[model samples]
Target chain A: EAGVVQSPRYKIIEKKQPVAFWCNPISGHNTLYWYRQNLGQGPELLIRYENEEAVDDSQLPKDRFSAERLKGVDSTLKIQPAELGDSAVYLCASNERGRNGELFFGEGSRLTVL
Target chain B: AQSVTQPDIHITVSEGASLELRCNYSYGATPYLFWYVQSPGQGLQLLLKYFSGDTLVQGIKGFEAEFKRSQSSFNLRKPSVHWSDAAEYFCAAFNAGKSTFGDGTTLTVKP
Candidate 1:
């Protein structure tokens, strides 16, 4: 079984530019999550999806950050007019339903906003 | 609000020595606990988890963790350290369908 997969392992953009990251979760997984990790810090949950429904997105920056999982298998996280502070690693993880602790993560997409 | 804390920012241990990483969590109810390791340029990998029953849980790569309800702590340990053990370790807690992660601890192994 392959682990979660993410695209654009690294991205560099100037401030005010738009950026997007994509993720493909493990097969048969019912839950997907997007997280952001700053330098020297652990990953913080930005959004979570159970199937096609977003069960949690309280921490997401609604003003500039948006995410969607149309068919529940893949997800996209977009940041429009990204600021310098938006530079960080965006990680995607997935797990089966009722299994909250066993998460499989992807290599993550590193974004640099200058 | 549930939260996880890793008191140590970094730790260095010599190879073949024992190792311990501290973690603490805050939650009203019993939250699911986990430990994950992330190598440089790699994704997070589950080291161990504690849901119920046993307080001590063993995981891959010779890792083990002890969950203490009284202390609200779940600490990771290894009997013998290896150079490959150098990586960033994160402690996480899941509660009420939400998850929280600590600031992570970077471990360095000295040969």
Candidate 2:
């Protein structure tokens, strides 16, 4: 089976520009997660989806960051007028329900804000 | 709040040498533990996991981790290091339907 797939492996944009990242979770997976990983740091959870419902998104910056999972399979994360500090790797992961949290991750979309 | 910590930011080992990467977690109860490896420009891959049974868990790529409840630690170990083992290692803890990851440790294997 194919792993989680993310598009635009690398992206470069200027500050105040809008950027979006897409993720396609593994087939039959019921849970999806979006995480941000700054250089030299571990991945931090941005949002989590159980099917089409976003169960945890408290960590997401509502002012600039928005995410949606359509049909409980594909997810998109958007950052409007992104700041320079937003440069980092956006990682998408997924797992089956009741699987003890074993997550399968994607190659990640690395964004660079100039 | 549940959290994970990896004290060593970087480690260097010679090929064929033994390796150990330390991981510590804080939670109200014993949480599900895991070790993941990330090669440069690649996604994170699961190495091993510790749930409820045995303290020692073996994983892919000749990696193993020992879960110690007394120490609140789950340390990854390899008896023989290989050059391909050079990568970033992350420790994670899952509880209450949430997962937390620690700052990774970069391992450099010398030939």
Candidate 3:
């Protein structure tokens, strides 16, 4: 039983450059989530997808950040013209569709904007 | 809107000593609570969760949490702390469309 897998464990990009992170959720998991964790702070929900539809994305910065979970199995989060403040660990988690279940997380992609 | 609060920023405990971390949540209906732990530069791991049925829920690693509906609190405890337990813990709750998380508490275990 493999867990969620995220690519490019660490990334460094210029402030004005574009960056993207990818995640492959666990098999049979119907729910996917993207979270941003800042220094000394908890991971904040950025977006959620139940299959191909993005159920929630109010917290995602529409101006620069965009995410899509095509086919509902894998997801990619992109940040264009990245800002210094955007530097943080981006985590991807998966869970079975239900009332409430434990969310299994990947190692996460740590981004650093220089 | 649902939100979680962790009052403690950091706590240090000696090995084999009792440990407790506080968590408070705000929600409209019945609350669904969760505790997650993360090691250095790692992703968050589920420690435990409580939806209903029992006031006290036992989690992995000999950790347990008590949910007090009246006080809107769900504090985690371990009778005897271990060095491997040192990590950052987060409390979270799901709301209308998304989940909210606390800032987190960093635990340091003294050998």
Q: Residue B41, candidate 2: how far off, in angstroms?
A: 0.5
State residue B35's C-alpha deviation in candidate 2, in Å.
0.1
Candidate 1, B4-63: lDDT as tens digits: 999999999999999999999989997999999999999999998999999999999999
Give model 3's DockQ, 2 decimals.
0.72
**lDDT per residue, candidate 1, A1-114, as tens digits?**
888999999999999999999999999999999999999999988999999999989999999999999998999999998999999999999999989667899999999999
Regions of model 2 farther than 4 Å from truth:
none
Order candidates by TM-score, high to low: 2, 1, 3
lDDT of 2 by residue, A1-114 (tens): 899999899999999999999999999999999999999999999999999999999999999999999799999999998999999999999999998679999999999999
Tell me how far candidate 2 lies from the true structure as C-alpha RMSD in angstroms: 0.7
TM-score of candidate 3 on Cα atoms, chains taken together = 0.97
* Per-model TM values vs. the true structure: 0.98, 0.99, 0.97
DockQ head-to-head 2 vs 3, winner: 2
- Candidate 3, residues B1-111, lDDT tens digits: the string is 567899999999999999999999888885688999999978899999998898999999999999999999999999999899999999988656567899999999999
lDDT of 3 by residue, A1-114 (tens): 999999899999989999999999999999999999999999888998998899888899999999998788999999998999999999999999884647999999999999
Best by DockQ: 2
The native-contact fractions of the candidates, in order shown, are 0.83, 0.78, 0.70
Which model is ahead, 2 or 3, in terms of TM-score? 2
